[model samples]
Target: MRPRLSLPKPHRRGFLTAAAGLLGVSALGGCERFAASPTGRRALKAGEDANMFVQRLLLTPASLAKEFPDSQISPWFKPNGTIDPPDRAYKALAARSFEGFKLRVDGLVERPQDLSLADLRALPARTQTTRHDCVEGWSAIGKWTGVPLAEVLQRAGLKPNARYIVFHCADTMEYAAADENEEAETDKTANPDMEARPEGAENQASDSQAAGSEAPGAEAEEAQGTPIRYYESIDLTDAYHPQTILAYDLNGKALPVSNGAPLRLRVERQLGYKQTKYVMRVEVTEALKGIGEGGGGYWEDRGYEWYAGI
Candidate 1:
């Protein structure tokens, strides 16, 4: 049997405590309100940015996450967030086994371009066995193969002002109005767990209209109080890190829909949530304010830490 890998646990409890204390409440309502309030929002953001600064200042950007040998690979890597994106566009691409899937690279670039899976594969590839740590307190090691994100950023001609790389995904996990976060939904009690979706809620809702198990498509969009866009971002320091990759293969096989087929971001040093799935677009921006809730990530908007640096 393979040993279960885990990050050092000494600080996990302290981190959670400080996070809860910072938000003023452990209950969902208080946490949400505090995170959404202007003063609380600024506090959380400053704390997040400060944490990021400390991580970058203390650790070299190119430092690698510990790598394991092939024998240590997990027998079955648990699919992390938004198993099957049920978006119409995503379905169209998956039908052909992602033969025509194109990753869009835009914003703060001299050239905005879309590259197909073949195009991405043509670039230099790096493979590494790294442990994936989830916020729910679990870890698994898998060998991931992909082109470095820095290579793609270079190809896109990242402008000097590109401060952060935003990952825009296909899941409709939103608490805000469609198109943008202009309006808030009255229902905020659905997900107190901060999971990808409320367990089977999204699956059942989408399956009712979708083609049953044939699609394995998500139900977040159709489900009430679902999460939105499933987005995340990292500053240029982490974005350019050697281990930060756009992975298309996991454990020596083509990535699965449940595991973010076509491509997913793999920032080895951060928590698993920082590595988003069903990545349809990469948008470079000078700031995070325009994205959902302006808190840095989907979970961050709902009270999780933005800088989930582990």
Candidate 2:
């Protein structure tokens, strides 16, 4: 068995809370000031890269994150990000208790697989109670049970060229749709014979359009005025870590919708955002380019550090 690490007590946890708050403020202010300038952004990115390098240098690749006992599990584990995805297709799956839900594992694999929750549950599983440290200065301990990511990766058979793992999720973020509208206008200009559709496409139901179309690695295509879906990525090293899992149960029960019900990532060593919720597709790729802004994660593209090590 792998050696287990232990976390500090409540007093030291308080110290971490204060330190996280200061770091959060500093990071936010720096981004607000420097993100717009090309040189400034590069400098910020350099700092992030350096942080990643130093952490990797100091810690062994397989070093486990600290774990706790059942008694130490927080009474209430707080949820962040999208608790309920606004996508209609996701709602349909959830309504039936995710019977039709299949987690798609594709991209740079010898054998791409579409795995049901039952398929995952049948695999050898790991259970651990660990503290989730959020960048927003809160922490909660919860027991998570799921298959180790390495097991799934091994089953998929990674291509030798694969360098990173990208996680596509169900939740989305709202942003101005001006760019989408502009692209539509440009397409119309090029194809003068194209028939024009009304604004908002008749507010059509997404599930109706996607009925019987549960292809492996398929995500809901963005519609005009629709939100951009959430995505995140990690390196192959972390992906294969013994402690990293695709958690389906939380605190001795099936994970609730409010807590990433169908499946969520438990990358114990990183901050909360890196533990992406509502995970749908796992894409293995050689590079981050063509992924969200080519920054490896939704928040990473928005100037947050991609490594986000705790």
Candidate 3:
């Protein structure tokens, strides 16, 4: 667990600026070497842990991010990252309006849970209008409503050894159509025989195309490797924050597919990247060593900071 939250000092604003440059170069750069080179690594490197430590030490557990008046909300909250996931299992769930979508919770807990959408909605909910600061230098204020994550953690009963909370998402980093062999190999669990397709289907939630991207139905070729689904983590301190929600609604409406339907993490204090979309599961673990090259997030694996404070 991390310390309580508090305000960052003026000197640390430089860290934020440096992080921006780090992110830009990271976008165009190599693998983990961003932190391992002889020269100072642009990514978090040694400073990553220090950043997390300072944030937790300074920030208060009860401190809240700025909330905007509803009038200030954006006309549209632009969606980034994988807009559509073409995974067959996710398609089926979305087709039925995610009636079958289950947010699986396991790892380092007492009672493991498989919570349905309704199950989650039935819990206590909070709605807040807050700014989403994206790493790409964009910001938007929108009202988000969902259950407080701490409530769920209490329900699950965290074990003594539990430390970091891992979020498994449905969004894939590499957007490529699955080849027949790959599809067939996963068919039994992911694409098993079922009723005819629904009117519309998609999690890696939207195959909705990005600029210069191919259509969903474009032939899936023999790519070098499989797509990597997005995942991220945070210490327990952030998880227990009153404003930390697993949001199902944006601006008083159910989140659209592009905005991480049926659920997404809303750690109000962190940058938008930490608010991973298309969340599928949550895992509690002591250390990050065994997960995704041990960097803590998809981008972190590439050299971005695990603690991307605003």
What lDDT does model 3 reach?
A: 0.73
Who wins the TM-score comparison? 2
Residue 278's C-alpha lDDT in candidate 3?
Answer: 85
Q: lDDT tens string, model 3, 104-200?
A: 8999989899999899999999999999998878787899999999978888888888888999987555533456455323212111121222332
lDDT-superior candidate, 1 or 3 = 1
Please give each candidate's TM-score.
0.75, 0.76, 0.75
How far is 67's C-alpha from truth in model 3 (Å)? 0.8
Give the backbone clash total of model 2.
0
State the C-alpha lDDT per candidate. Answer: 0.74, 0.74, 0.73
Per residue, candidate 1 scores C-alpha lDDT tens digits across 1-310 of 1112222323545555456555554444666667677866666765665566556657775788899999999877776556665465677777777887889999998889899999999999999999999988988899999999989988888776778899998765535555455675633322224435333332233322332333333465444334456789988877878899999999888887767778999999899889888899999998999798898888887778878888
lDDT (10s digit) by residue, model 2, range 5-82 = 232223444444445544554667556565567756655565565556556767887899999989999877776566
Cα deviation at 229, candidate 1, in Å, is 1.7
lDDT of 2 at 28: 70
